[model samples]
Target: MSSLEIVKQYYTSFNQKNWNGMLALLHPEVRHEANQGDVRIGTGKFTEFLQKMDESYEETLTDMVFFTEPADSRVAVEFVVNGIYKKGEEGLPEAYGQTYVLPAAAFLELKEGKISRVTTYYNLPLWIELVSKPRND
Candidate 1:
């Protein structure tokens, strides 16, 4: 499969919250560089991260645009993340189902049709501020 197709399928599975489907597209030793976090290696680490996120937040990705250059194996994607903080995280403001939307970008490297590395970037302060504000409802 082409890199574009692989990436498209990955996101589609992600949107569906199909954890197995998403993990199937990744290498066993996939490298993950989560936004504002240390680089983690292996699918085990990725699964743990997903579990933690699932516990703390409910999120969806929207307005996605994927970019790739000729002769490059990397794909960069821009999207908006809309999320509700369901539980408080360490060193973060309290969570009371506060919803926030923010634009983010991710760079992915594919190896033999499987994602080997992923690095994402997003505004942490903007998210914290938005989620920290007092909710009217």
Candidate 2:
């Protein structure tokens, strides 16, 4: 498969919350960086991250727009993920069914048709608010 196809499927798998499919597109030594400075490496760590994301949200990914330039070997994706709280999360100020439309982007690097490195850029502060976890004490 081409890099673009691989990346596209990656998003599709994630939106579907298909852990197995998502894992298949990831390199064994894949590395991921989110908005935070923290860097996650290894398949185990990546798997954990996916698990947490799935466990937190109630709905699946909705509208998404993908932009790519074949020459650059990079793709930028913007999407709105709608979901509710899973209940019993300490920072959760409200119950389930709260709707959130988060606009997020990700920069990806492909190697051998697999995702090797991913740098995620998004408004994390906005997410905190959407998830009802205000940073202010």
Model 2 TM-score, 2 decimals: 0.80
lDDT of 2 at 97: 49
TM-score of model 1 (CA atoms): 0.95
Model 2 root-mean-square deviation: 4.0
**RMSD to true structure for each model, in Å:** 1.1, 4.0
Model 1 residue 14 CA deviation in Å: 1.3
- Candidate 2: residue pairs that collide: none
Indicate the worst ten consecutive residues by lDDT in candidate 2. 87-96
lDDT by residue for model 2 (31-136), tens: 8997775799977899987777667666566577777786646777777666666643454465554566777778888777778888887686786678665435
Put down candidate 1 lDDT per residue, 11-40, tens digits, no spaces: 898888888888899999999999877899
